[model samples]
Target: MKALAWLALAGLSCMAAADGQTQFAQKANATDVERYEYATNLDIARVIHTENIPDDICEVVPIHIFYEDSHGERHTLEYSVMGGHF
Candidate 1:
């Protein structure tokens, strides 16, 4: 009975840690998206870079995008896009 209780507690702790990490990642992704969006003025953008992150843990994706403003100046920005099953 005591061993079973200990095992249950351990499992719960692990779950809590996983949840915390997921939340942290989500907040970080949101902040990055907002920051990038605010700092750029682009008429059209295209993905210049991509990296495959682990899908099991989080849904945030890293991408480098390029765009041109009205003045014909090109800008490259890094953004974290949160996408997955809702």
Candidate 2:
């Protein structure tokens, strides 16, 4: 019972979507993020940056996503390497 509780607690630490994969929340939206899973023309790299601004202004630190992608191909995205940040 205690082991099961531990597992449940660990799972709660991550947010899961319909795909049942754990993902971190990004400050940017879909438009800001570029997805490239299987591409032949682009080698993209992203970095997630966070900063606290002065005067009560919070800076949006974007997430950094890095992966490879091909041209003119339908690529499925996953939690590990899917979208780009910043």
Candidate 3:
């Protein structure tokens, strides 16, 4: 019984860790829009993920980018671009 309890506790801990990592990716709709400029100071180290553009639209649309900075902090940036340009 004690061994089973330990196993269950270990499983819960793993799940908690996974949840924490996922929280880093801000929701697309919840993130603020970031206008791009020629002199914008960005510290992006790597692109973690980019929201997919809808196929039914052909105009400029908001795109959400999830990235990790040089300091290992995650961030989400929302910008507008021509749809289906990927």
Task: Report the C-alpha displacement of residue 49, candidate 2, in angstroms.
Answer: 6.4
Task: Give the Å shift of residue 30 in candidate 1.
Answer: 21
Q: After superposition, how far is residue 42 of candidate 3 from its true place, in Å?
A: 1.5
Candidate 1 residue runs with Cα over 4 Å from true position: 1-57, 83-86
- Candidate 1, 1-86: lDDT as tens digits: 44323322433343423454444433434334323444344343322222333345446665433333466554444555555434
11-42: candidate 2 lDDT, tens digit per residue:
34432233211122233355545532333233
The number of the candidate with the highest TM-score is 3
| Per-residue accuracy of model 3 over 1-86 as CA lDDT, tens digit each | 44323322433343322344455554434634465444556666756655565677789887655667799977676656567644
Best by lDDT: 3
TM-score list, all predictions: 0.32, 0.21, 0.57
Which model is ahead, 2 or 3, in terms of lDDT? 3
Which residue pairs show backbone clashes in model 1?
none
Instruction: Please identify which of the two predictions, 1 or 2, would achieve the higher lDDT against the true structure.
Output: 1
Of the two candidates 1 and 2, the one with more favorable TM-score, higher being better, is: 1
* Deviation (Å) of 39 in candidate 1: 6.5
